[model samples]
Target: MNVLNTDVLVIGSGPSGLAAALEAHRNGANTVIVDSFARAGGQYWMQSKYGLERNDRQMQAGANFITNSENLGIKTITDAEVWGILPKYRVFIQQGSRDSIEITARALVICTGAHDFVMPFTGWTLPGVMTAGAGQRYVKMYGKPPGDKIVLAGSGVFLWAVAATIVKAGGKLEAMVESSSNQFRLFSLIGRHPSRWTETRRLLSPVLRSGVQRLNGYRIDYAQGEDRIEAVKLRQVSNSDRDASQELEMETDCLLVSHGFRPITEITALLRCEHQFDTKKGGWYCKTDPETGATSIDNVYAAGEVTGVTGAQSALIEGALAGLGVSEKLGFTRNGIERKRARLMKRQLRTARFADGLAELFELNTNSMPRIDDNTLVCRCEDVIWGDVLKSWDDGAQNLQAVKYWTRLGMGRCQGRICGVAVSRLLANQFDLDPRIFGFNHPRLPLRPVTVNVVHDALARKSL
Candidate 1:
């Protein structure tokens, strides 16, 4: 095992991680970044492997930022997944087909980003059904459309961005179905942030020009397919009615869906940091100081979506603040650090307000839970259906762990990352209780699945 040391270790390479690394390096800390992807940029700024022309604003910005990091001599470990963290800020990583390496750092900055929040429906496990984030990555990073014909259905502005990307990739978009009926709320949000209008137009124009059907106040009732998705059934949704009888069936080879994003907080949770549940902030998120981005634990900080899903703009600012905080803690504060921190703090306030409105505008509709039948699979990894969970409840299972023990709901390769919240919502809607009462699935070591040899090698170095 190769052992390394750094003054600061940043886990993730997205906007927040890059910004944090840049700030820490400039402040005289030997900062290092590690990402699970093949390249440095994360989902928001995923780089194309085909050397595709850089036309989009995000791509160009990501390219420039990555270049700056390299020019500044910031060390980044690509294709490395941090599977475990030990006492004294010792991190263990597993790279592809290589022996695991351990890095001991003085301080740690966690910026692990978020993933799509998807609900289960009939035929959701079909071959052609996937989350919008997956579809975007397929098109943007791999330069391949998910399917020849795609129908995007979900709540939130992210669908529009995916639709634009599909259109750009020359994929035929059948329609875009949004669950939120309150377009006025979205317009009002954009109205306040005038700078967003340009981005709004940029994402929406291509989809509209292609004449894709845009349906608001609609939700996917279920998907229809054999082995793969060939069509989808969508029903009208409204606050007053909850479920309207009117339904629309669309033919498409692919169905991309996402209710919203859920923050990836396994690292923070594993470290025993304080967390608070807020749906608007993307479920359970790490609690951090607004001024410094410091978590409850000493020498550890969290930023970006791990703190909350506030988009890239806020992540960048929060990352900088966390970097500055770490530098100050390590007694390496540079001149004028306070002034820079003040400016970032003010900008974060504005972005946080916008994030609040965005969350409200695209809030998931709990009423739709009733439409999912008993046979629908809630935990895709474990193949646990809603009926199984209900049966567990009837058998005296009151909380998440009891249900898991009875039905094997959250014990899979994903380790409840995908199915924990979905099952919680199912039980809450059925029993009319708070979702938090079920609590969250406790995170265990080796956060992601790794080869047995990798774990053995890591353990051979030191007792974790």
Candidate 2:
């Protein structure tokens, strides 16, 4: 195997990754960035491959980061899907269309980021039902609207952004149903965290101007269609009387739903880093030193959404701190490094306060998900339903491991990334146990899907 060594290896190209790479390079370290996408920007600044029009202010911020990183002589390798990482900072990356090489770093910065948190609702497995994030990507990145008529439903401010993107793409939004009450608490937090004010303004502008029907305290009860989603059933969330919870049926070609985001902790978990279960942090996050972003393992630091679901501003600031911390740890430091770290921490804290408020306001109401009937599909990859999990539980499966063994719940192509949380939620609700106790499915080598031939070739090559 070809071994490429670097002083620092940053494993994402988003705002956080870009900042880390730039800062580390500035501190006199040989740094390289690897991302799964074709471009450097993460989800917040996802660029269109076909050169789509972007009016959102977030795009400019992302462009600035990209430009700064390029000017600092930072090297970025796009379309490199990192499947595995070993101890002593060895990274196994697969880029079949290009060169597949293994990377070894003196220090590692993990900014793997987060993915859409989708709680299973009735008919969620339907073809026309997608995540709000996916809808945004379709409109902004793919340069195509998801459908002619769209219904956006979920928590968080992200849905509004998705709505805006659709409107910008010249698609009609039938309605937007959010579970939150739009209370004053979230509004009050915006005042304290001025860093996010620009983004907040940009995301809300299109929605306010589009005049889309906004249902403040409503949640999707279910989606109904045979070939594709034609309509959705919505219920008023604030109503105390279940029967009086006004039910409305709205016709739509697509239904986009997302609760929030869940951090992609597979790599950190595989590294045996200690993690803490915090719903507000977007499920399990790698526990790190807030001052340095260092994990339990020496020379291994985590930044960005891998640590938590705090927004882009916090991610960028934390990345800078981690980059500086790595530089100092590697004996490459400049004057007043401590002062810089302190300033970054303060900024991170301010952004985090606003993020926390959003998380609280748009927290995934586990209660909002309609009760899963026996036939309701829970694990999409394995095609396992609620009945299958119940059967495993009945067969002396108490925790996730035993359940997985009996039902093959997490043994599918996704490697339990999607189904693990759903399984945990189901087990917790059924047994009245803490969801964290089940932990996550124990991670193994070859974290992502790889071709059989590629795996065989990798095994054939001797370790350096």
Q: Each candidate's TM vs. the true structure?
A: 0.97, 0.95
In terms of lDDT, the poorest run of 10 residues in model 1 is 365-374
Runs in model 1 deviating more than 4 A are 240-244, 368-370
Candidate 2 ranges beyond 4 A from true positions:
96-99, 238-244
Highest-scoring model, lDDT? 1
Per-residue accuracy of model 1 over 220-307 as CA lDDT, tens digit each: 9889887789989988885566566578889989999988888898899999989899989888899999888799999998889999
Which residue pairs come into collision in candidate 1?
A: none
| CA RMSD of all predictions | 1.4, 1.8
For model 2, how does the per-residue alpha-carbon lDDT over 12-110 read when each residue is reduced to its tens digit?
A: 998778888887888899999999987889888787765553455577678777877888788888888888887788888877543557888998999
lDDT of candidates 1 onward, in order = 0.87, 0.82
Instruction: Return the top candidate by TM-score.
Output: 1
